[model samples]
Target: MTGLGTLDAWVGRTIGVGWLPTRRDLDAYQLRCLNETIGKARVESPFYRSLAGWPETSHLDELKDIDRFPLTTADDLARGDPSLIALPLRDAVRLVTIPTSGTSGRQKRLFFTEADIEATVAYFEHGMATLVRPGSCVAIAFPAERPDSVGDLLMRGLDRMGAIPVALPVDGPVEALVAALRELQPAAIAGMPVTLGAAARCMAADGGPPLRIETALVSADSVSPSFRTALAVIWGTEVFEHWGMTETGYGGALGCDAHDGLHVRETDLHIEIVDADTGRVLPDGSEGEIVITTLRRRGLPLLRYRTGDSGSIAESPCRCGSVLRRLRLAGRIGEPVALGDGKRLRPEVIDDAIFAVTGVIDFLVEFRSGRHMVVGLVTSDPRTVDEVRSVLRSHPAIGPALRAAGIDIAVEIAVDPPPPPCRKRRVLGVEHVA
Candidate 1:
């Protein structure tokens, strides 16, 4: 695996990386890849045929101005445009569907070719190396029983590394998950944060079977500070975070031992942080919506695809020894509420306010007209609501922030199984009240 062979191993060679691109080499490679994708889309994909902001085929300099490209939103994919698909259905090896948060909205569909799946597996082969040593058994809690499921691809990668993966998809109750945990004491586990958080709570409450797990890889949602602390204390393991979406064909970025930020898959994708409203690319370290361009994707080559999740790029290099940049994720852009005084209250603020109180499973800070907040909660006991209210009231800034803006909050804790697993419950969300 020397020189070009190593390069071939890195990219699997449809795009052909002759060498590991550095600073300007990175830009050149991305530009070359982007142009090729654009050219292909113009011919095959119906969507990019009429799609705007394509730079002149020969002029690579124009690629620097990516703002010229149209922003692909969740709505774009939801509409089920035939033109978005670059290849015929026969060419695809896998397809994934993502349902949006709202009750009634179009589900996003993603198509992956064999090469795409290989790319993902290769990424996991390298990514999981950060957490588990070779031959270590890991309880893969992700739903991988299906074809090309994240779990399957990860398992394939683990096989390459000699890791024994207990491929368990999170499909049942927390008790079932706990039962599996008791049976197979795998060294590590990776899955959705909400699902895993619920399992953690269940195990902690029941004093359930303690496994020899060393790490929990939580992805999709940002882990609240209190929840992370609880998992660390109860499970006695380091909690590593992952950031990815359906459009990313699953895994996009992963954290290193330093845990400063998630190392971006820079060679395969180009990520940008832009002001949500203006579509202006923010400087590194400035929080904004994450937009990505698939530098080497063949299926649905999304140009400047706007992912509604909010986060920023690290301004400095990571101690992880990789030159690839990292992303610092905040909550979803839609999760924050704007006040009459132009003040914005992030959901994290309320998370600290409520989770500060004990016996709380989860909560949703829904906002109504007149800046009113309905605190929907799931708690263990009678003391939960009052304790939650007390914590918010005790917060010097929360009280003043709400009072100055004429906002009122009402708390409601459910006695029954509120809605679903506590993890699916939002700590802060906005709902329009007519």
Candidate 2:
């Protein structure tokens, strides 16, 4: 049986107690797991074998050599053949299908074995230890009945730690979820920040029972710091952020107790930040596209896969004592825009400038183009809508990025009633007809 207590203790000790692995030790283990998984893929999967010259050695000549492998992108998998299905169907126990947000593509089905599900549950057990008390409960806003879904896996993890887990069917109304939460009064809540934020709004409006939630885990979307603070204020608890995708078996990385950058599951995966255009690896602290290699994945293993999230890696020692590094995922990959004056705009940089404004309690950025770029913002304050626009207009990057993109952009602000929920699209893009 997987030992939840032991893993939880080790992780806690790693962070604060004592005796964590050294950098050298972690590297050796990563190399070993990488080699083992690669050997399996080459032997059992035609997709890997079809590579013109798959590395045959047991060891990587240089870590940078990983970039030489072709990136497994969304288009590649959407058009993939049966041969790319790495594991035998007999051994595969679960399947997860995700639709591409691209303008066009079929849903991609990911296969996993029982071991994969177990691995995910084990990670959650340790990760959730930061929030779950042995006798308490976890309120999940996602579906838990689906076979091997993230909610189900989390329930198993919490169960192993002697905590109860409850959820309303995902498709069910949020009001039902709010009522159940009021009844269960779980010690921790897990859901998208927006979903929780929306639920908090419903509770505030309906004057419901106190949830008594101690902490929360927010995932499945990007949120601004102000937005997170707003969510926390409604629920009266700290929100711990999580960043992951279905491709990573929904268990890539999570924030530690310190609530700094997220600590990647470096033991089971290797992460890299690469220049989006050149695909060259960037040094720590440089913002770029995120590339991931699964060290322990069995069915449908991914190597040098582009995750399409914009983020940076920080190797500096964290506030926590653990040796593991952190990833600062800013948001999803952005589109290119040419400024009316011929300077290319940096969308993420604009994101920084807009979010940095003092009164932007929580906001959504909307862009519709014409001769110039027109920017629309939704903010928390309904009374000072124009003032919010003034703050953004005075930003250093917004004007320059807009002017450089050669698009005639205008800034509009609206004072909305509350924080944006998970269902709120942070960025809404419209094609420029001109």
Model 2 residue 399 CA deviation (Å) reads: 8.2
Q: Report the lDDT tens digits of candidate 1 across residue range 177-283.
A: 87888788778888766566656665666655665568877785476787677677767768888888768867888776677788777667888898999998899
lDDT score, candidate 1? 0.71
- Model 2 residue 384 lDDT? 41
Candidate 2 structure quality by residue, lDDT tens digits, 1-434: 11133443554343343545666666666777776777787777777778664555535655666666666676656766645667778888987778877767687777888887887888887778766778777888766777788888888888888888877444555566677778777778888765676566556556566555778887743556654665566677778778888888888877766777887777577888989888888999999988888877877888878898888988686666556668887777754344445454444445545544433433455565445444455433444456555655566766556555544445566443333443423455644211
Candidate 1, poorest ten consecutive residues by summed lDDT? 1-10
Q: List RMSD in Å for every model shown.
A: 4.4, 5.4
**Residue runs of model 1 more than 4 Å from their true location after superposition:** 1-21, 56-59, 101-104, 208-212, 337-344, 362-382, 396-413, 418-424, 427-429, 432-434
- For model 1 the TM-score comes to 0.83
Q: All candidates' TM-scores? A: 0.83, 0.79
Candidate number achieving the greatest lDDT relative to the actual structure: 1
